[model samples]
Target: MHLEAFLYGGVSAVLAELASYPIDTCKIRLQVQGQVTDDALTAIKYRGTLHTLMSVCSEEGFFSLYNGFRFAALRQATYGTLRFGIFFSIKRMWNDRGGTDKNLPFLIALGTTAGVTASILTTPIDRMKVLSQSTAQTRKRKIVNTFKKTHSKGGISGLYQGIWPNAKRAAAVNGAEIPCYVFVKDFLTNTLGLEDNMLTQFYCAVTASAVGICISQPFDTAKTRIMQQKTHRTDIRVYEGFFDMCRLTISNEGRRALWKGAFPAWCRNGPWNIVFYLVMERFRKFDQWANQRDHSYF
Candidate 1:
């Protein structure tokens, strides 16, 4: 059962990532936009989501919209697998212990645990994805070359450049998203007496996405800046730490700058969450049907 959940989660997440890669790319570009150079003349290539998409398409071509696609998929595979799989397993255990899935606190705690574990485990891939997507390096570099370059600079530690912020972002996102999703779904099913159908799941996912992005955007921005920083240059260190990054962003770019790529983040996370839940629900139904058929045949 755990294996099935892990496989389904990974496949669903990969599909979600593929469908939402362009939005994600735009978000990263936006987050790292002002950080590339302080000069106002060259600082603002990507003004917003639509502008960034159009600019990248016109200048770098449409395919460039998927610039770190492999790393994105890899991140989803490991991170998503651990998150969904662990959460599912924990929920099953709780249910077995006579605990209800409607327990909001339990759901939030489980989600946070799963999210932090997955984030720490997959930070290297997340870092690679951010660097590959950022505009700091103009040329499109292969993942192998990116890894090699990082390894050469700071050994293995280079691979986890912004792990602290990344993990915190993941914790915030999944903690909010998973609990909100569960709570919403339960409310619709139990209180509103809605059927466990596509519409209910879609609404739940949408609510979760909104909540998750709102809570996680600031940390996401910080993580992107940290990862995109040139680690070799101590003189050019843009952010000393997570708090420092937040302070610098607020002090320099104003408080709203903390949500630099909020629109793009919502664009990416909303559809991604919708696709993930829909696909995972389908997988669950398929598995149940298969098991029933096998048992009847036996």
Candidate 2:
């Protein structure tokens, strides 16, 4: 709960976000391609990770891979600030009511509240990020064309067409996923008597995120699906938007169709989380220094 911890969380979120862009790009393609009957990975064949990058470049264009990266950066900055600073502040305020570190329920509440608040605040930005990344074409590659097309649709709000779906997605992810992360960290540090060193901290951090990720990935898949549908929610099309996408998916492909991109998700989650935890360590240290200096904690 030190200032260093907050700084580390913020730094980690940004660094991890940049590091995870490739996996994210691939994930977007998998979902936007919309072939629920098949494994999303098999949709594209490339040599390796670098090959995937090359393919997206040669096929999708150079700027294709970095689609919505700016939006993602914004979301991470906002989410990280709220999650670490606001959530911790709220948690601490609640903790002042008197409770032992052994209270898993208390910690869960803190993580959930923080995740929910951050997700809601940043959902609009995240929607833009998703739309930008998934604006792929089975036909040709035109970066400017895609941008113009998307921008012309509903402007900024058009890009954020699926914020409601995202809210649902965030609830499961942040409500349960993030809380479980801190819970795991707490268990490892206290009940398990784990040392509070770099390795332990990193493990705890990544483990928390990874677990949260796995739990929330399906919802993420659903969210991406909803956003990339390219029609008004009120449209009478068989699949106008998120809820319609959900209905079509369930009726056509069954319930499991909703989780079409889990494989790529795991691939994305591993590296993304590794980078995230490592970066968070630095942020926490920075937060600590800034807070102590400001408060004269010395």
Candidate 3:
């Protein structure tokens, strides 16, 4: 069961990431916009999601939208596997204990824990993905080359740069999204007497996406800026750390800058969650069917 959950989670995440990659590229570009320097080009290049997508295609070619596709897949395969597997296992344990799966607090705790645990292993992949998407790196680079460059600049520790923000973002995102999804689904099914159908799933996913994006956007911005910063000794580092980044962003760009990429993030996450949850649910059903058939054969 656990292994199946891992497989389903990874596969679902990869599929979702593929579908949402373009929007994600836009989001990252927006998040790190103007953080590279005080130059006007960097500041004004990506005006919005549509503009950013068009600008990237026109300037960097259409395929450039998937700059870090492999790293995104890698992050999903490892991070998504651990996150969903652990969350599923915990939910099953809660069920076995006769605890209601609709317990909001418990679900939030479980999801946050799962997200933080997965971030430890997946932060480097995330770092790579952010750098790949940054406008700072005008040329396309291999993931291995990116890693080597980062290591050469700051040692092994450099690979895990911005991990704190990443972990915090993950925790906030999952804590907001997963529990909200489960809770909303349960509420719709039980309280509202809605069927567990596509409509219900869509509504749940939308709600979860909105909540997750709102909670995670600020940290998401901070993480991207931190990861994409130049680490060379001679290059001026923009912000000292996570808090410093937040302070500087607020001071320079105003508080709204924290949500700079929010719309693009919604564009990425909303459909991604809808697809992920729908696929994951289907996989769960398939797994159960396969298990039942196996038991019958035995």
Against the hidden reference, what TM-scores do the models get?
A: 0.93, 0.76, 0.94
Off by over 4 Å in 2: 1-8, 35-54, 61-63, 137-152, 155-160, 232-243, 289-298
lDDT of each prediction vs. the true structure?
0.84, 0.65, 0.85
The sequence of per-residue lDDT tens digits that candidate 2 reaches over residues 71-166 is 777778888767766555655555566654456676666766777777777766676677677755444424456456766876876666667677
What RMSD does each model have against the real structure?
Answer: 3.1, 5.1, 2.9
For candidate 3, write residues 1-298 as lDDT tens digits.
4577778888999999999999999998888776544352255577899999999998889989999888999999999989988887778767766877579999999999999999978999999998788764567778788788888888877998888988999999988998899899989998989998888999999999999999999989988988877666454555677799888888878899999899999999999999999988777667769777431100
At residue 214, candidate 3 shows an lDDT of 90
User: Which residue runs does candidate 1 get wrong by more than 4 Å?
Assistant: 36-42, 136-140, 293-298
Q: After superposition, how far is residue 58 of candidate 1 from its true place, in Å?
A: 0.3
| Model 2 lDDT on a 0 to 1 scale | 0.65
